[model samples]
Target: MNKISKRPRTTLEQKIMILNHHHKSQNSQAETVNHFKTKYSISTSSFSEWLKDEQNLRSLYNNSNEFLRNSKRKLNFKYDKINKEMDKIVQSALQENQVINEPMLRQHWCKLVSIYGVQDPKRISSFSHGWLTQFKKRNGISKNKKPIELVENDYDLFDSN
Candidate 1:
């Protein structure tokens, strides 16, 4: 004859502490669940269900370590929004300039980057080049802006005008 054994229930605080500890230790959820089951003599599936039921645990599991339960700190940087604003700036510069030539685009791109305080020269060059390439493709404009005869067959696309 087999006897059913009663397992002691883990408190919410204990579960949260276990979750937090495993999270800080950079263990995967599966690993954490397995470790807890072994250490506490509990069932992994039940623990997983409890984590989903608790709002804080749900948030913690979904958001990783960036979330703080008590603090209202904003984690996003203004620079992360640079691309959208820069695209607008580029579009406006193209409209104002009346022609989306490489030199003009580069100038406006650099100016926008300066305004945005993105000071790296290499990054400025890269962003300008990439955006210009996409802009050219989107607008269906040829990089060959000069008179066909005067244009060199292989003029470097991003070379200063």
Candidate 2:
């Protein structure tokens, strides 16, 4: 029996590099596929599959440009920093015995969004109620109030019949 070896998977970066080179060369899609098949031993079906994903293709194209990629990385970093700051604020509020009811939570998030919105309009555009809910869930912030338990000492005081 003959055993067939599986081809190595292509990394996203490699795919991007190949696509960028193909685009710069201004070759037809078929020609590009043929070139990669001959050079890298990748299958035509694989190229077709990769190109079929419109969103991924667009992202790869955008990332191929250094300026666009750097801007995207910076924007992502800003969003991450905003999220971290918001988490700290929420944690501090919880530590201070503040209840995380919908109104209170929404108000807090609105203030944060407004504060950060001045620096980046895109940040404000991405804020939504759903994001708040996801944040709360991620931080383990619960909506239901937990009942306080009485200690044995407190029970003894109440037993003075």
Candidate 3:
């Protein structure tokens, strides 16, 4: 009896690379399949699936930054509609160059989730710290450099010579 090997999980970067090479490679189809099979341990069927899913991969890559590119798993937003609304609010704030810290994000998220749970009084949901981190990555939100406050009046209190 032969034991079956587990299929290798492809990262987002790996998927994009494979798709790009598939389009640009001068080699024949079989050769391209062989190359991916050898390097990524991905089967021909999986490669075909990636080719079909090229657009989605491209969209994911375009929306994400370098920090999130190499991740092996893609996180799907559980509360899709709620998340979209929250994302819009966050995006507007970011476009205005406003500083959105963790607390502010949490407050918004909590309020959004609460609003969604209105029909079911007992239904409750809250975003986790991990979710917040991933949310920032998904939306390309980052901390701006801290600005120092300037004093209005200087050297007035010091009278010693």
The candidate scoring highest on TM-score is 3
lDDT to native, each model = 0.53, 0.55, 0.66
Q: For candidate 1, give the lDDT.
A: 0.53
Any residue pairs clashing in model 1, and if so which? none
Worst 10 residues of 3 by lDDT: 148-157
Per-residue C-alpha lDDT of model 1 across residues 1-161, encoded as one tens digit per residue = 99967554554446667767766888766778777774564566765775576676555444432223322222233345654554464456446544445554555567667777787867565454455554454334454542211122333343333
Q: Please identify which of the two predictions, 1 or 3, would achieve the higher TM-score against the true structure.
A: 3
Q: Which ranking of candidates, highest TM-score first?
A: 3, 2, 1
> 94 in model 2: Cα distance from truth in Å?
1.6
Candidates in order, TM-scores: namely: 0.31, 0.35, 0.65
Error at 78, model 2, angstroms: 7.3
Residue pairs clashing in model 2 are none
How much lDDT does candidate 2 score?
Answer: 0.55
After superposition, the stretches of candidate 3 with alpha carbons farther than 4 Å from their true spots are 1-8, 26-29, 114-125, 137-161
- Candidate 1 lDDT trough over 10 residues, lowest sum: 146-155
* Candidate 3 residue-wise lDDT at 48: 73
